[model samples]
Target: MMAGRGTSRRQLLKLTGAAAVASAMPFSAGSAVAGERRHGLSVFGDLKYSADFTHFDYANPDAPKGGKFIFRAPSWGFNQNIQTFNSFNSFILKGDAPPRMELCFDTLMVRALDEPDAMYGLLAESVEIEDDGSTYIFNLRPEARFHDGSKVTAQDVAFSLILLKAEGHPQVRLPLKELLDTEVLDEYRVAVRFTGNHTRQLPLLVAGLPIFSKRYYTAYDFKQSTLTPPLSSGGYKVGKHAVGRYVEYHKVSDYWAKDLPVLVGQSNFEVIRIEFFRESQIAFEAFKKGNITYHEEFSSKTWATEYNFPAVEDGRVILKEFPDDRPSGAQGWFFNTRLEKFSDPRVRRAIGYAFDFEWANKSLFYGLYKRSQSFFQNSVLMAEGQPPADELALLEPFRGRVPDEVFGEAYLQPVSDESGFDRTLLRQASQLLREAGYTRDGSILVGPDGQPLEFEFLSNSKGFERITLPYIKNLERLGIKANFRLVDPAQYQSRLNDFDFDVTSRRFAINPTLANNDRDLWVSHAGEVKGGNNLAGIKDPVVDALVDKALNAITREDMNVAARALDRVLRSGHYWVPQWYKPVHSVALWDMFGYSNEPPHYDFPVESLWWFDQDKAQKIGKGG
Candidate 1:
């Protein structure tokens, strides 16, 4: 019988004192700024929070005051690669926004108010998807042009696809991947014809691709464009870029999309500037020094201890948690099966058993995160208990390849059930190590190679240093010589591109519908040498077939079936060690900004609403 702790069970029993506990908690914001509070806004009255929600509400925040907002971003301050550069222009890969929002471009289809699950046109007039979903026609709004005053035509849309595919976006051939052809029907009308039943998710893909000026690219050099202030159709235009120091975006006085419904409540700042820091510790110091106004915490220790800086005592810093439903995605050691050691299935499963999640979470994270079970987080189609009839229908085709247990149990099952870490799990882990032809001495697994089973654990973030090192210590106890290798950003990109790591941690995400996901993560066709997304190097026939089914699936029923099949193949392979997930967004900002109580969409709207509270905010930073 399993002896691991049941967090869900404990959570239910512990809910009794939750409200009283929250009421008894001391106020985090130290002192309110003394001055005339416009609208008498209460700093703690009603605030919206989220892990990934980008939308800002207009009602509470009021009209966005035109002011400069500076932040520290990982992408803007460092040297970006070709993929990162092209990603700004790439249509299907639009969600690649960094912690500090990218300055070069913007999305065209913001989430709609009436249809929270769907997106409304931003740059385009209206997008028409055929009843069969096999064909899509887009009609661009007239007079919409780049900053250079060149009208964005259907040809530009067609070129964006062709160029992105040639350049190698993981989502290069996304919604259009299944399309037979992308045709320019007229000056404003562009039509896409699918090879099979089209997915409703295609519109979201098309809406996301940044609409670049074709003529501008043809006249100016592609590589030289970034050096110059590139022309844009979004709310802001590049004002200055020091490359590796800071990049600034100035809101256009007369922006083209300002009146669009999608632009109603978002991008209120008059200027947005991002500073780059080589080290997170330096960045935090800068935050304390008031150089940046916002920072997201990834380490539990930092969340608990680091905020005690003088800024928190001075009422400038604020820590907030928002509800999140977005998938947690995996952040674990991803084995590149293309490598010989991981080619064997038994070795991979043995590794899954080796990492102790419960122990690491309690010891290192202060018990903040829940161990993730599947690729999807808390969502139904992601493979929950007993594989519902909907999921089983999808899993049927690849029946034997997937573990029978996944259909009836969690995709990731612990060795124990004690509600937390247990020594028995480690004992069972050791036995599995023995089965994999290894023996542990104090903390190292010696394999048949007569050498210890050692592997390099590559990571890119400093916060991960705290969350992951504890697990590495546990691996040491299991006799696995896992070494931590923290590489700089440039080196990390080079390694990921070359597929040169023993194991690396990262996350993958999808838009709402879960469509086009298979092509990006699983399909062999996406693994081309030039630039494919088969990061795992997965090429199994069972996975390939399931991917095809999911791609061609029209009805929700068929899509679920195909997804289940793909999920089975991914889980059976044990390519990843599980990690933690939270349904809420964790954002920290200076208390200068205000927001609505209701979520703009599912959480916070990124593109549509949210703004700076000028009067109250200015007073908060008055003395400091």
Candidate 2:
């Protein structure tokens, strides 16, 4: 199970934006009253910068910010930790914090990455909406301070949304369980309240959370985990760090919404840093010894055999690619299904016919990935071939509660024949594990309570033990027993926030607009909520009412037909073996910096949109 906080929702609202909002909703309640007051917001259309737009046309704001950008954190967010960390209180999951700690606070809105679901305000300078959408209010920005210049009030945004919904971190308290209360209506206004069974993307996920500092967590303990650096206000803070080998952040020369228009040219690195490496070939040999300076790559056999090095023969490393226009989301191998030997969907489609992914993409991924067939992959809300009549009118009331091959077709995976082990797809994966009661008891596979089918894959990266030891030798030729384990990045996020394990490997970026972090990935009470992103425990109530009918649709073609009928009932619940995605991003960097143009087709957040080039950092001597 390989991972990196390839995570989203930290999955820390990764790259902090999911383009779009306002498909006509703006302040209303009962027969819809209350209107005016907005700066920006989008659900999927109508809002590509207006309301006195100053910055963001993919932010350049006259580029050239400062120096030191650094890299290696290809992704991370809330409960962060890319490979090492020990709390600076990343909004509490108790310890192992680090990765871009939402760049030290500030959030009553911020997100526009060239709009797809816009969001404008910074420390709220506007916002109104009311009841029918379950109230909101915001206002703030009386010079909103906070990295100790104090005053960021509305009683510190109603004490950081009432202590992150009473002690945050289940990736900030599971979509703030429909957040029902915050109020402080004075010191520069506030209000919030929700629970009208929230989720029309809960007011830009409560305007991108984070605020805090109600007098520095009223003298500590936002559910413990501390290394002290609490109070901040944005555009970076929390300088020198080392616990897991690198951290920084710095910037903020008087941050306070640094020229907000959804933060002008964005956190332009006056030292961003990050680094962390616990493996991915020791962070690609510290980006081939340049000690990391914006890598990204996520290995396709070390980007088709070790990027040639010697800084790519003198150009001092460039490699690039970029194009990732968002939504390559769900990378796979999930299956924890809150165990009972993975409660049969024909034993998770007979363990996805022992995964060959075309002989692991031609002998370990150098054909450079493609396989991931939609948890909304490369988007248009991904559920292709069949079911079209507005996704069969949202799957005609869950037609006999799901899986008639999720209304035929639309669940592909299982092509194999590159024969890493395909004996007729392992005899149709051992006759669907002997019609889901499993057998071969003479050698090992047992189950049906006679116990032997064994588990454990867990991982914190032994780079997927050469891709899980050839899919545990095709599940030991179907006699089962698996293995792998690996552990370490703090017990692999404390055993994926204690759902413990029976298989893992994650990727989850999933953004293109269906926010409220798609209820931490296909809800069912956020798969029993302890530090979410629903790592396949799932639960289902018709995949929780087609993910609340695609997070309360309202057009974007009815949220892509309730997200293609909730991605054909989560790819007909084989709950993932999926994996492989590319659309572009590979990166490599260190030829200094400078971007301000491409990227931002809904985020490529290269250390908050690149910069610092001092003449390409003095011709790659990596200048100041």
Candidate number of the best TM-score: 1
lDDT of each: 0.55, 0.77
Report the lDDT tens digits of candidate 1 across residue range 1-624. Answer: 000111010000001132223322322222122221111111121223222333334333246657666665322111233112322222222222122223345444544432324455655665554424445567777777776667778888776655544442444443355445678989987775565433444445555556667777678654322344556666677676665667677787767777654455667777676667666667678777878776655556566667888778877787787665544454456787787667766677766765667666666666677877676556544655566676666566556766676566556647444333356766777777687777665555677666777788787665566656666666666767777898876677567756788888765543334555435566665554323445677777667666656544444456556566566567877877766766555556777666654543333442224566677577786322
lDDT accuracy of residue 108 in candidate 2: 83
Write down the TM-score of every candidate: 0.80, 0.35
Residue 560, model 2: lDDT of 79
Q: Write the per-residue lDDT of candidate 2 for residues 245-289, one digit (tens) a residue.
A: 888889989876787766677677788878787887888887788
- lDDT of model 1 at position 608: 26
RMSD of 2: 19.8
Q: Which candidate tops lDDT?
A: 2
> How many pairs of residues collide in each model?
31, 18
Instruction: Give me candidate 1's TM-score against the actual structure.
Output: 0.80
